[model samples]
Target chain A: MSWRSELQALRDDGFDVLDWLSATEEDDEVVVTACLVRSEDPGSFRLVRSPAPVESVVDMFPSAQWHERETAEMFGVTFEGLNAAPLLLPPDSPAPLRKAQPLPARLSQWPGEVDPAKPRRRQDPPGTPWR
Target chain B: MAMNPRASLELIAENCTSCMLCIRACPVWCLELDAHLEVDESSGRRRSSLALDRFSIDYGTCMMCGLCVDICPFEALEWSSELPPTQFEWRSE
Candidate 1:
């Protein structure tokens, strides 16, 4: 499914609430999943998904900004129109999720325990490790 | 920590991530994110843009399931025992 049309359809359904959006890379494509809940039901939901990155709903749903950023950062899919700077993955790190033999960092969380009070020191430090 | 269900979040200074996840997650969109994030000499983080200006926990409209707390990755936010003293009047709708 085209990413744009699918997202547009979500807009048509009036999915004003964003639940969660995540992505995974296939051999040659990235699949993005966006879940939204109906305002009336709140918890009862609908999910809008696509296997392509060409279509984008970042314009229709302003909140999709972060979703697209993380998707592009981790899965390497281009959101034809989203322009927000990357929110997670380091500014200088190469997107490793796109490689044929992607490194564990692409799928792995920081190696050490995460201390809520301390700075994150376990994530890849940058310099485009896989690029 | 089991907090009072009738609590207000004013003093918690629950800084919004501007990730807008709360707005996205809010069933009522009552949680509004505005542009008040800025440097505060009190807070020492070099980069000091906090999320929304201030979030109102519409006591009448909130659903106390802790979803808001769950979505806040910054830990700048938390629930409190009582509503902090407010200077602005709340909107009546």
Candidate 2:
């Protein structure tokens, strides 16, 4: 069965979404997890994970709108029913949290006692094409 | 007045080994340094030392939190309450 139906069934079973977040995974994919807490027992909670490009459960859970929008913008993921609006970040800014994204600094060498042989962050000039 | 040793920042520039531990500890990025290594002709050995070209702390932004003094591995930095009044020959603004 689809995750939308599963989330709805859980909601009917007195589960409420406490929070939601996303993390990058292997193979250039992302995972979105929802923290659901049972209404009868706030101490008991469950983490539900689903791969990116998954269907949005915002229609069944209105609180998922911000979460879905944030995940979509950060990981370049798509949600089937989500509106075309930016959230959390300015429109057109790079997805900084993604593992593939380049860091902001350009240190010529490591400072202090750090091992010099260890690879440092890439120092691409601004406006260079991103990988 | 007896100065409190733990309330102000001090630096013994000659004792610095330039390890840059204090630079990394600065939360506001107020510390800066430039260094170079060269062979000492008399000693016949290579030695590293800071150039003092850009080793300046922007007092405007420094919160005086003392993280830089505490993190100096070479014991070059210290805290003292004997700091003199701010004296400037000119003003930028």
Candidate 3:
């Protein structure tokens, strides 16, 4: 069945769109998830996952427009049928949230293993690696 | 290490290199650092370093996760047993 068919089935079964978002995994794969809340039980939610290059469901659910646009901007995923325009980022800006994107050199201390008592200053402000 | 369990955060501003690891590790994102690069031409070797103008952590939103204390490469942040004053004149700014 098509992705739209799955969403329509959920809608027919009395489910409402709660939230939609996408994330880039460590392996460089982008995954989009949508939460559908049961109308009778607001506390219960069903999560739906779609890998990158999936079809857009904005036609079935208008609320998914912004979410699809955001996923496209961050992960470079094309949401077919949605407006192909930058949502939260500028047009000239690169994909800053992609897993493979280059990061600032200063953020190399992510592991927290470096002792704080040492002077780790580098010759360059944020380009050269600290000794 | 022997440390006061009830102490708040202690910061050694001069030792900080403004690497921003602590800022990213912070769960609440309460720590803020305003820094810029400057060149030191006085010495034979011209070296550029970051000049931190303002470094403030909002205790109002801080959860004291201690990630900043552990991740600082320069031992610039520490935990002190003496907490900040409880009473303060509330300002709108």
- Among the numbered candidates, top lDDT falls to 3
Q: Residue A92: error of model 1 in Å? A: 4.2
Task: Give the CAPRI rating of model 2.
Answer: incorrect
**Model 1, C-alpha of A55: deviation from truth (Å):** 2.7
Cα lDDT tens digits, model 1, B6-75, are 4655324444345555544554334544433456566565665543444454555555556666676766
Candidate 2 C-alpha lDDT tens digits along B1-93: 766666546667767655667766765555565554433567676653443323455555567888888778777777767653342111112
TM-score of 2: 0.58
Each model's TM-score, in the order given?
0.41, 0.58, 0.54
- The number of the candidate with the highest DockQ is 2
Candidate 1, Cα interface RMSD: 11.9
lDDT tens digits, residue span A37-131, model 1: 76777877778667755656666777778887887877767777678477776786777566565555434332122222233533342333553
Docking class of 1: incorrect
Looking at model 1 chain B, report the run of 10 residues with the lowest lDDT sum: B84-93
> How far in Å is the alpha carbon of A119 misplaced in model 2?
19
Q: Which stretches of model 1 miss by more than 4 angstroms?
A: A97-131, B1-93
Off by over 4 Å in 3: A105-131, B1-8, B11-64, B68-93
- Model with the higher DockQ, candidate 1 or 3: 3
Judge candidate 1 at residue A37 and give its lDDT: 72
State the DockQ of every prediction.
Answer: 0.02, 0.14, 0.07
